[model samples]
Target: MAARILAAALSLALAAMPARVAAALDMAGVFDSTGPEITISWEYLETPGRKAEMQAVIDGFAAMVDNEFLPRDPHAGIEIVMTDDAAHFASYMRRNYPAIDIPKYGVFVSDGRLVTYSRSGVGTVTSLLLPGLLRDGYDDLPQWAVTGLRTYFEKFYGFWETDAAAGQRVVRFAHGYHNPWRLQDIRLLLPDLKLANLVSDTPTVDGTRYQSQQRLLMIFIWKEGKLPAFMAALRARDRKMYPTYLEAVFGQPLEALQPRFRAFQETILAHWNLVMRTPPSQVYADRATFEAMTASVWR
Candidate 1:
């Protein structure tokens, strides 16, 4: 009876304990680096070089995502759990996510934890994570926005390269235009790309076709210098006055802006790669060199 009473009391105490305290109690010795954006705890007993490499991976990921795609402090300090122990990773993931099946790497959306295996290639990790985070961040925004933030994100990130020479490792990051996403069939989808329909609560040529169509809307608002306010309205979920917000964002009547939006979209679609998609080489290499190589894109 005493043992049962003590166990019950301890359970109550732990249940009432703060989450940070419970986490520390659970893994007192293995806590690792804490960053402004993310805290990392790892279960790797590897060489110092390998350890540093994993930390670099974590840091690079944080840098890529440290933007408005997610609101500031969305999860109140999200955490990364890195491990080389495949068996333990599998067991813990199974326990935490019973019904849903995730691959070797995943984020616990509500619990504020993301798990990654150290040996997994960097490209794999970054590609998978961006969309998940983008989807989550954009969730609070109006659904009509499709939050096109993910398309904007892909234009700058999702490419990784590594090179080492003369006792130094040089890591290179590169990004290009959006993937094909049925650009060939875009002609078939073009007729349905009216501005009003794109922004309405309906599927516009399936999800893939929405990227460039929605991107045009974002750029139009961005050019009008009201993109931030427009996003704020969406993020605040201010649907009651969103029509007013839209009028303000466009700074013109809907009929007037619709044709302007379409023309802008058409001009860019003429040469999608050259017009809008800035390649990574254009970002880092000298302008003259990139122009000679990729023709007119400035790095």
Candidate 2:
């Protein structure tokens, strides 16, 4: 009888203790009240502000190309992992993708994983990232795809034009201006653009030079012609018959369009274009001093 009483008393004491105090707590879930609606897991560790800035860039990009493609669907939201250290980044990549060649700076992936090397050949590779996203090219993209995407981005993302005398033009950076290129109407200045007769991504074309040409052509289209219709046509695959598409678009054959495109090219050359200037330097915030410098620049 005494043993029974003692057991009952102990049981009551245990039952009376608060659940939280009595049980092992899962601290990780404390702040994670909601389940994963859209899971984003990254290897990169960032401060609150930097993380927020990255999120904003993601949001802006989503807004730019959302539902533009067929099926009228929102892009499957992505996970952007940022690494604080190169060692960690490399470890993550090695663990996740063993076969990929590491990228030069950072990689962009749509359907496939992008491995960015801290360096690529002799130069820092940044253009590779932007075009990767724009074209959704996983591992490989043709020269045309690269050039075409570059052209598309320059046009959609408007810049500050520094106009000088004697028909010189310079593009200044615009703050938070999305979709610089206006691709709606391509008629007002058709003759010169037609003269250039620019076709992006042809066989035997110099890719780097072609990309530069494509950017200029896009600018000319926005300034002189109906850009949106052209974009629509291109997107719809109606442009497979290139000359016919041109004729239908401008009510003229390629011969008529050639002279105009050439003239347009001349005018474009007259401007002090920096669309394809020197490549950008790789940005690393690993060092405290470098981080401070970057912060100051942003400030």
Candidate 3:
């Protein structure tokens, strides 16, 4: 009888509260732990090879961080708080972490805590590694460099589904810079994206374009194969050094690189156009070809 009364009182409080504030505290089991088993989805268990594939990706990423990128431990390791509720996560982030760029569906890291909203399947694997690399000296790393490196490693987010064929499982992953994103159609927005505008202190104030713009620049950086050199050289960095870094790292003025940049985008846009024209079956018919074409841009 007391429990029923308590529940009723809580409901009344929730009804009276503002929508945003109410949503922020709406909790349905938040697991605040950092363990491999914690993130294993039910879909992985039901699929035969999915567990192994996902684990391999996870293990490989951890190894790279341990051996190559960050040899020492972060002074304070990350405390991950994951929840299934997207509105709860968004509201909490907005209230508590106003300065951080709250991804509509991905993980966001701040202040030794890695928070994720599982409504979109934990976002891409690339972003999950942020807490690992974000340590003592990294906060000063420019936002463009940070976003670019993270988005550059991001390939796709794949999930298994029942195929039309008998006893078949098909994998469909959004394979692009905008995987698991709210904004997928950049056709109308791309025309106005310029490197000169991008290389400024802040790439964009618009939430929709900020990630995309940083990603666009990073693809060029990776294709140039100077990612390490680029990141390293920029340690002597400044907010205004982005254009200078591009010129120094690419061995050309920003003006010269613009055409080359446009050429690369043209290739990507051409591929996108062709895929739009083709039927779904034809578009995904050659997984190898599609994956190759997507990764080819980075190479």
Give the alpha carbon lDDT tens digit for every residue of 168-219 in model 2. Answer: 2221111111121221122233234433235523433354444544555545
> Residue 292 deviation, candidate 1, in Å?
8.1
Tell me how candidate 1 scores on lDDT: 0.43
Shift in Å, residue 285, candidate 2: 19
For model 1, where is the 10-residue window of minimal lDDT?
Answer: 21-30
Worst 10 residues of 2 by lDDT: 22-31
lDDT of 1 at 183: 42
How many pairs in model 2 have backbone atoms within 3 A of each other, for residues 3 or more apart or on separate chains, i.e. clashes? 45
lDDT of each: 0.43, 0.35, 0.44
* TM-scores of the models, in the order given: 0.55, 0.50, 0.50
Top candidate (TM-score): 1
lDDT of 3: 0.44
Q: How many clashes in each candidate?
A: 2, 45, 0
Model 2 error, position 186 (Å):
24
For 1-299, candidate 1 gives per-residue lDDT tens digits of 11111111111111111121111111111122233444556554444554344444444333323332235443345555655555665665677667867674432333566664444433234333444554544554444465454443333322112222222232233333333343443545543366666666665556656655565456566655666677666566654543545665666656676777666556556666664344331122333443354455422
Of the candidates numbered 1 and 2, which has the greater lDDT value? 1
Candidate numbers sorted by TM-score from highest down: 1, 2, 3
